[model samples]
Target: MKINSKKVTVQKSSQALCEYLSDVKNFEALMPDNISKFELIRDDAFVFALKGMPEIALEVKEVEAPHKVMLGALSDKIPFQLTANIETINANTSQVELVFEGDFNPMMAMMIKSPITKFLETLAGNLEQIQ
Candidate 1:
Protein backbone atom coordinates (compact mmCIF):
# COMPACT_ATOMS: atom_id res chain seq x y z
CA MET A 1 0.00 0.00 0.00
CA LYS A 2 1.07 3.59 -0.61
CA ILE A 3 0.95 5.92 2.38
CA ASN A 4 0.67 9.71 2.52
CA SER A 5 -0.19 12.15 5.30
CA LYS A 6 -0.68 15.87 5.78
CA LYS A 7 -1.34 18.25 8.67
CA VAL A 8 -3.42 21.38 8.48
CA THR A 9 -4.11 23.88 11.25
CA VAL A 10 -7.31 25.82 10.91
CA GLN A 11 -7.54 29.10 12.80
CA LYS A 12 -10.97 28.37 14.17
CA SER A 13 -12.37 27.10 17.40
CA SER A 14 -12.05 23.33 17.85
CA GLN A 15 -15.76 23.20 18.47
CA ALA A 16 -16.38 24.75 15.11
CA LEU A 17 -13.76 22.57 13.49
CA CYS A 18 -15.29 19.45 14.99
CA GLU A 19 -18.72 20.54 13.89
CA TYR A 20 -17.56 20.99 10.30
CA LEU A 21 -15.48 17.83 10.20
CA SER A 22 -18.26 15.74 11.67
CA ASP A 23 -20.52 16.64 8.83
CA VAL A 24 -19.76 14.72 5.63
CA LYS A 25 -21.47 17.46 3.69
CA ASN A 26 -18.70 19.88 4.66
CA PHE A 27 -16.22 17.72 2.76
CA GLU A 28 -18.23 18.15 -0.39
CA ALA A 29 -18.10 21.88 0.08
CA LEU A 30 -14.44 21.99 1.08
CA MET A 31 -13.32 19.62 -1.67
CA PRO A 32 -12.31 21.14 -4.96
CA ASP A 33 -15.02 22.19 -7.38
CA ASN A 34 -13.70 19.67 -9.88
CA ILE A 35 -15.64 17.00 -8.04
CA SER A 36 -18.85 17.08 -10.01
CA LYS A 37 -20.65 14.60 -7.81
CA PHE A 38 -20.16 13.41 -4.26
CA GLU A 39 -22.42 11.90 -1.63
CA LEU A 40 -22.18 10.27 1.78
CA ILE A 41 -24.31 7.17 1.77
CA ARG A 42 -26.39 6.05 4.77
CA ASP A 43 -23.78 3.40 5.51
CA ASP A 44 -21.52 6.19 6.81
CA ALA A 45 -19.48 6.24 3.65
CA PHE A 46 -18.92 8.60 0.77
CA VAL A 47 -19.09 7.67 -2.91
CA PHE A 48 -17.57 9.61 -5.76
CA ALA A 49 -19.33 8.51 -8.93
CA LEU A 50 -16.41 9.71 -11.02
CA LYS A 51 -13.07 7.99 -11.43
CA GLY A 52 -9.41 9.11 -10.87
CA MET A 53 -10.28 11.18 -7.81
CA PRO A 54 -9.11 8.85 -5.08
CA GLU A 55 -10.78 6.07 -3.12
CA ILE A 56 -14.09 5.23 -4.77
CA ALA A 57 -15.87 4.81 -1.46
CA LEU A 58 -14.76 5.98 1.97
CA GLU A 59 -16.22 4.44 5.15
CA VAL A 60 -16.32 6.26 8.47
CA LYS A 61 -14.93 3.66 10.83
CA GLU A 62 -14.46 5.70 14.00
CA VAL A 63 -15.14 9.11 15.46
CA GLU A 64 -14.11 10.68 18.79
CA ALA A 65 -16.23 13.67 19.64
CA PRO A 66 -14.46 17.04 19.16
CA HIS A 67 -11.18 15.21 18.76
CA LYS A 68 -10.71 12.68 15.99
CA VAL A 69 -12.43 11.00 13.06
CA MET A 70 -11.19 8.05 11.02
CA LEU A 71 -12.35 6.93 7.62
CA GLY A 72 -11.24 3.87 5.67
CA ALA A 73 -11.38 3.12 2.00
CA LEU A 74 -10.32 0.47 -0.50
CA SER A 75 -9.20 1.76 -3.83
CA ASP A 76 -11.57 1.05 -6.67
CA LYS A 77 -8.92 -0.83 -8.66
CA ILE A 78 -6.29 -1.67 -6.08
CA PRO A 79 -6.60 -3.87 -3.00
CA PHE A 80 -5.27 -1.31 -0.53
CA GLN A 81 -7.01 0.11 2.51
CA LEU A 82 -6.85 3.89 2.91
CA THR A 83 -7.46 5.41 6.31
CA ALA A 84 -7.68 9.13 7.00
CA ASN A 85 -7.53 10.54 10.52
CA ILE A 86 -8.53 14.07 11.46
CA GLU A 87 -7.45 15.33 14.86
CA THR A 88 -8.27 18.51 16.65
CA ILE A 89 -5.28 20.33 18.14
CA ASN A 90 -7.40 22.52 20.40
CA ALA A 91 -10.47 24.70 20.48
CA ASN A 92 -8.83 26.94 17.90
CA THR A 93 -6.81 24.50 15.77
CA SER A 94 -6.78 20.98 14.27
CA GLN A 95 -4.70 18.55 12.19
CA VAL A 96 -5.40 15.78 9.68
CA GLU A 97 -3.33 12.66 9.19
CA LEU A 98 -3.88 9.94 6.58
CA VAL A 99 -2.63 6.37 6.46
CA PHE A 100 -3.01 3.98 3.52
CA GLU A 101 -2.11 0.34 4.11
CA GLY A 102 -2.32 -2.81 1.93
CA ASP A 103 -0.31 -4.88 -0.48
CA PHE A 104 -1.24 -3.57 -3.87
CA ASN A 105 -0.02 -5.36 -6.94
CA PRO A 106 2.37 -3.38 -9.25
CA MET A 107 1.44 -0.12 -11.03
CA MET A 108 -1.86 0.20 -9.25
CA ALA A 109 0.04 1.62 -6.30
CA MET A 110 1.16 4.64 -8.31
CA MET A 111 -2.29 5.22 -9.70
CA ILE A 112 -3.88 5.14 -6.26
CA LYS A 113 -1.22 7.11 -4.41
CA SER A 114 -1.22 10.23 -6.53
CA PRO A 115 -4.89 11.05 -6.23
CA ILE A 116 -5.02 10.29 -2.52
CA THR A 117 -2.08 12.60 -1.98
CA LYS A 118 -3.66 15.26 -4.11
CA PHE A 119 -6.92 15.02 -2.24
CA LEU A 120 -5.18 15.40 1.09
CA GLU A 121 -3.29 18.37 -0.24
CA THR A 122 -6.47 19.96 -1.43
CA LEU A 123 -8.11 19.26 1.90
CA ALA A 124 -5.29 20.95 3.77
CA GLY A 125 -5.38 23.88 1.43
CA ASN A 126 -9.10 24.22 1.98
CA LEU A 127 -8.76 23.89 5.75
CA GLU A 128 -6.18 26.68 5.82
CA GLN A 129 -8.69 28.85 4.02
CA ILE A 130 -11.41 28.01 6.52
CA GLN A 131 -11.76 30.39 9.44
Candidate 2:
Protein backbone atom coordinates (compact mmCIF):
# COMPACT_ATOMS: atom_id res chain seq x y z
CA MET A 1 0.00 0.00 0.00
CA LYS A 2 1.10 3.54 -0.74
CA ILE A 3 -0.09 6.79 0.70
CA ASN A 4 0.97 10.30 -0.24
CA SER A 5 0.77 13.38 1.88
CA LYS A 6 -0.27 16.86 0.89
CA LYS A 7 2.52 18.95 -0.59
CA VAL A 8 3.60 21.88 1.51
CA THR A 9 5.85 24.82 0.72
CA VAL A 10 8.57 25.49 3.22
CA GLN A 11 10.51 28.67 3.79
CA LYS A 12 13.84 26.91 3.86
CA SER A 13 15.81 25.47 0.97
CA SER A 14 15.81 21.75 0.20
CA GLN A 15 19.30 21.37 1.57
CA ALA A 16 18.30 22.95 4.85
CA LEU A 17 15.19 20.81 5.15
CA CYS A 18 17.11 17.62 4.43
CA GLU A 19 19.74 18.59 6.97
CA TYR A 20 17.09 19.02 9.61
CA LEU A 21 15.52 15.68 8.71
CA SER A 22 18.82 13.82 8.90
CA ASP A 23 18.75 14.10 12.68
CA VAL A 24 16.21 11.98 14.52
CA LYS A 25 16.23 14.39 17.43
CA ASN A 26 14.91 17.13 15.18
CA PHE A 27 11.66 15.26 14.55
CA GLU A 28 10.28 15.95 17.99
CA ALA A 29 9.09 19.32 16.77
CA LEU A 30 7.19 17.86 13.86
CA MET A 31 5.14 15.36 15.85
CA PRO A 32 1.40 15.46 15.79
CA ASP A 33 -0.72 16.68 18.67
CA ASN A 34 -1.81 13.12 19.37
CA ILE A 35 1.68 11.93 20.01
CA SER A 36 1.56 10.51 23.52
CA LYS A 37 5.21 9.63 23.83
CA PHE A 38 8.47 10.29 21.98
CA GLU A 39 12.03 9.29 22.80
CA LEU A 40 15.29 9.38 20.93
CA ILE A 41 16.92 5.94 21.07
CA ARG A 42 19.99 6.77 19.01
CA ASP A 43 21.46 9.46 16.84
CA ASP A 44 19.42 8.13 13.93
CA ALA A 45 16.52 6.32 15.56
CA PHE A 46 13.57 7.03 17.82
CA VAL A 47 10.44 5.49 19.33
CA PHE A 48 7.09 7.18 19.49
CA ALA A 49 3.54 6.34 20.45
CA LEU A 50 0.32 7.96 19.44
CA LYS A 51 -2.73 8.18 21.66
CA GLY A 52 -4.15 4.88 20.53
CA MET A 53 -1.35 3.13 18.69
CA PRO A 54 1.48 0.97 19.88
CA GLU A 55 4.86 2.61 20.32
CA ILE A 56 6.75 2.09 17.10
CA ALA A 57 10.46 2.38 16.60
CA LEU A 58 11.73 4.14 13.51
CA GLU A 59 15.22 4.83 12.20
CA VAL A 60 16.76 6.93 9.50
CA LYS A 61 17.21 4.24 6.88
CA GLU A 62 18.64 6.19 3.96
CA VAL A 63 19.34 9.77 3.02
CA GLU A 64 20.02 11.18 -0.44
CA ALA A 65 21.65 14.38 0.71
CA PRO A 66 19.43 17.33 -0.19
CA HIS A 67 16.75 15.36 -1.99
CA LYS A 68 15.25 12.50 0.00
CA VAL A 69 15.25 10.98 3.45
CA MET A 70 13.81 7.53 4.02
CA LEU A 71 12.78 6.22 7.42
CA GLY A 72 11.67 2.69 8.04
CA ALA A 73 9.78 0.85 10.72
CA LEU A 74 12.04 -1.09 13.03
CA SER A 75 9.40 -3.75 13.61
CA ASP A 76 8.37 -6.39 11.12
CA LYS A 77 4.90 -6.29 12.62
CA ILE A 78 4.31 -3.22 10.47
CA PRO A 79 6.73 -3.17 7.63
CA PHE A 80 6.92 0.25 6.00
CA GLN A 81 9.12 2.92 4.53
CA LEU A 82 8.30 6.59 4.79
CA THR A 83 10.11 8.92 2.45
CA ALA A 84 10.38 12.65 2.67
CA ASN A 85 10.64 14.06 -0.84
CA ILE A 86 12.12 17.52 -1.01
CA GLU A 87 12.07 19.69 -4.10
CA THR A 88 13.94 22.89 -4.68
CA ILE A 89 11.54 25.70 -5.36
CA ASN A 90 14.16 28.46 -5.20
CA ALA A 91 17.16 29.56 -3.20
CA ASN A 92 15.06 30.11 -0.09
CA THR A 93 12.02 27.93 -0.68
CA SER A 94 11.28 24.22 -1.00
CA GLN A 95 8.43 21.79 -1.36
CA VAL A 96 7.85 18.70 0.80
CA GLU A 97 5.66 15.66 0.31
CA LEU A 98 5.69 12.43 2.28
CA VAL A 99 5.21 9.02 0.71
CA PHE A 100 4.37 6.04 2.90
CA GLU A 101 4.85 2.58 1.47
CA GLY A 102 3.72 -0.28 3.63
CA ASP A 103 3.45 -4.04 3.34
CA PHE A 104 0.09 -5.07 4.73
CA ASN A 105 -2.64 -7.48 3.87
CA PRO A 106 -5.63 -5.89 2.21
CA MET A 107 -7.66 -6.14 5.38
CA MET A 108 -4.94 -4.57 7.46
CA ALA A 109 -4.46 -1.82 4.90
CA MET A 110 -8.11 -0.92 5.02
CA MET A 111 -8.02 -0.77 8.77
CA ILE A 112 -5.10 1.60 9.15
CA LYS A 113 -5.41 3.86 6.13
CA SER A 114 -7.26 6.74 7.72
CA PRO A 115 -5.08 7.24 10.74
CA ILE A 116 -1.92 6.70 8.78
CA THR A 117 -2.87 9.33 6.24
CA LYS A 118 -3.61 11.80 8.99
CA PHE A 119 -0.26 11.08 10.59
CA LEU A 120 1.63 11.64 7.35
CA GLU A 121 -0.27 14.82 6.55
CA THR A 122 0.41 16.23 9.98
CA LEU A 123 4.11 15.60 9.68
CA ALA A 124 4.28 17.16 6.21
CA GLY A 125 2.29 20.18 7.33
CA ASN A 126 4.68 20.78 10.17
CA LEU A 127 7.63 21.09 7.78
CA GLU A 128 6.71 24.70 7.16
CA GLN A 129 7.65 25.54 10.74
CA ILE A 130 10.97 23.70 10.76
CA GLN A 131 13.61 25.63 12.62
Candidate 3:
Protein backbone atom coordinates (compact mmCIF):
# COMPACT_ATOMS: atom_id res chain seq x y z
CA MET A 1 0.00 0.00 0.00
CA LYS A 2 1.12 3.53 -0.72
CA ILE A 3 0.03 6.64 1.15
CA ASN A 4 1.07 10.18 0.40
CA SER A 5 0.84 13.07 2.80
CA LYS A 6 -0.37 16.51 1.93
CA LYS A 7 2.52 18.74 0.94
CA VAL A 8 3.47 21.46 3.39
CA THR A 9 5.44 24.61 2.79
CA VAL A 10 7.86 25.27 5.58
CA GLN A 11 9.43 28.61 6.29
CA LYS A 12 12.88 27.15 6.66
CA SER A 13 15.70 26.10 4.42
CA SER A 14 15.77 22.53 3.23
CA GLN A 15 19.13 21.93 4.82
CA ALA A 16 17.94 23.11 8.21
CA LEU A 17 14.87 20.92 8.14
CA CYS A 18 16.86 17.95 6.94
CA GLU A 19 19.41 18.35 9.70
CA TYR A 20 16.71 18.53 12.34
CA LEU A 21 15.00 15.44 11.03
CA SER A 22 18.24 13.47 10.67
CA ASP A 23 18.41 12.99 14.38
CA VAL A 24 15.95 10.49 15.76
CA LYS A 25 15.61 12.35 19.03
CA ASN A 26 13.92 15.26 17.27
CA PHE A 27 11.04 13.01 16.26
CA GLU A 28 9.37 13.40 19.62
CA ALA A 29 8.13 16.80 18.57
CA LEU A 30 6.59 15.31 15.47
CA MET A 31 4.69 12.53 17.15
CA PRO A 32 0.95 12.67 17.68
CA ASP A 33 -0.21 14.12 20.99
CA ASN A 34 -1.99 10.92 21.85
CA ILE A 35 1.19 8.81 21.94
CA SER A 36 1.62 7.37 25.39
CA LYS A 37 5.17 6.06 25.22
CA PHE A 38 8.22 7.20 23.29
CA GLU A 39 11.74 5.93 23.75
CA LEU A 40 14.93 6.66 21.93
CA ILE A 41 16.98 3.51 21.55
CA ARG A 42 19.86 5.12 19.73
CA ASP A 43 20.66 7.88 17.32
CA ASP A 44 19.12 5.85 14.56
CA ALA A 45 16.29 4.02 16.28
CA PHE A 46 13.30 4.67 18.52
CA VAL A 47 10.06 3.11 19.63
CA PHE A 48 6.71 4.73 20.19
CA ALA A 49 3.30 3.53 21.18
CA LEU A 50 0.15 5.18 19.95
CA LYS A 51 -3.02 4.93 21.97
CA GLY A 52 -4.68 1.53 21.47
CA MET A 53 -1.96 0.36 19.10
CA PRO A 54 1.00 -1.89 19.53
CA GLU A 55 4.40 -0.33 20.11
CA ILE A 56 6.17 0.46 16.87
CA ALA A 57 9.92 0.66 16.41
CA LEU A 58 11.56 2.52 13.58
CA GLU A 59 15.11 3.00 12.42
CA VAL A 60 16.68 5.37 9.99
CA LYS A 61 17.22 3.49 6.75
CA GLU A 62 18.59 6.22 4.57
CA VAL A 63 19.48 9.92 4.71
CA GLU A 64 20.33 12.01 1.67
CA ALA A 65 21.56 15.17 3.32
CA PRO A 66 19.17 18.08 2.65
CA HIS A 67 16.81 16.19 0.41
CA LYS A 68 15.39 13.07 2.00
CA VAL A 69 15.25 10.76 4.96
CA MET A 70 13.82 7.27 4.99
CA LEU A 71 12.73 5.30 8.04
CA GLY A 72 11.85 1.61 8.13
CA ALA A 73 9.85 -0.37 10.59
CA LEU A 74 11.77 -2.66 12.93
CA SER A 75 8.91 -4.98 13.64
CA ASP A 76 7.55 -7.89 11.65
CA LYS A 77 4.04 -6.90 12.59
CA ILE A 78 4.24 -3.89 10.32
CA PRO A 79 6.67 -3.83 7.47
CA PHE A 80 6.80 -0.28 6.16
CA GLN A 81 8.98 2.54 5.05
CA LEU A 82 8.25 6.19 5.67
CA THR A 83 10.10 8.74 3.62
CA ALA A 84 10.36 12.49 3.91
CA ASN A 85 11.23 14.33 0.73
CA ILE A 86 12.37 17.93 0.80
CA GLU A 87 12.45 20.35 -2.07
CA THR A 88 14.08 23.73 -1.86
CA ILE A 89 11.72 26.41 -3.09
CA ASN A 90 14.13 29.26 -2.29
CA ALA A 91 16.74 30.29 0.20
CA ASN A 92 14.19 30.80 2.93
CA THR A 93 11.55 28.25 2.10
CA SER A 94 11.12 24.57 1.31
CA GLN A 95 8.35 22.17 0.36
CA VAL A 96 8.07 18.93 2.32
CA GLU A 97 6.27 15.74 1.48
CA LEU A 98 5.84 12.45 3.29
CA VAL A 99 5.21 9.06 1.77
CA PHE A 100 4.40 5.82 3.50
CA GLU A 101 4.82 2.44 1.85
CA GLY A 102 3.57 -0.56 3.69
CA ASP A 103 3.60 -4.29 3.02
CA PHE A 104 0.02 -5.09 3.95
CA ASN A 105 -2.52 -7.53 2.62
CA PRO A 106 -5.75 -6.25 1.14
CA MET A 107 -7.65 -6.71 4.37
CA MET A 108 -5.07 -4.87 6.46
CA ALA A 109 -4.70 -2.12 3.91
CA MET A 110 -8.43 -1.58 3.84
CA MET A 111 -8.50 -1.42 7.61
CA ILE A 112 -5.71 1.14 7.91
CA LYS A 113 -6.13 3.39 4.90
CA SER A 114 -8.09 6.21 6.55
CA PRO A 115 -6.23 6.58 9.82
CA ILE A 116 -2.82 6.20 8.25
CA THR A 117 -3.62 8.82 5.67
CA LYS A 118 -4.64 11.26 8.34
CA PHE A 119 -1.53 10.49 10.36
CA LEU A 120 0.76 11.09 7.41
CA GLU A 121 -0.96 14.37 6.60
CA THR A 122 -0.70 15.51 10.17
CA LEU A 123 3.01 14.74 10.20
CA ALA A 124 3.56 16.67 7.02
CA GLY A 125 1.60 19.67 8.26
CA ASN A 126 3.51 19.70 11.51
CA LEU A 127 6.77 20.04 9.57
CA GLU A 128 6.03 23.75 9.42
CA GLN A 129 6.84 24.00 13.12
CA ILE A 130 10.26 22.36 12.89
CA GLN A 131 11.87 25.62 12.04
Per-residue lDDT of model 3, residues 1-131, tens digit only: 99999889999899988887788888888888888999999889999888987788999999998999999999878899999999999998999899999999999999989988987877886787766
Worst 10 residues of 1 by lDDT: 74-83
lDDT of each: 0.64, 0.93, 0.89
TM-score of each predicted structure versus truth? 0.71, 0.97, 0.95
lDDT (tens digit, per residue) of candidate 1 on 1-131: 65666666778665677566666666776676578678877556677643445436766666676666665563455444544455667756667655666576668767667766776677768877876
Ordered list by TM-score, greatest first: 2, 3, 1
Off by over 4 Å in 2: none
C-alpha displacement of 131 in model 2, angstroms? 3.7
Q: Which has the greatest TM-score?
A: 2
Please report how far candidate 3 places residue 88 from its true position, in Å.
0.3
**What lDDT does model 3 reach?**
0.89
Model 1 TM: 0.71
Clashing pairs in 1: 14-91
Candidate 3: the clashing residue pairs are: none
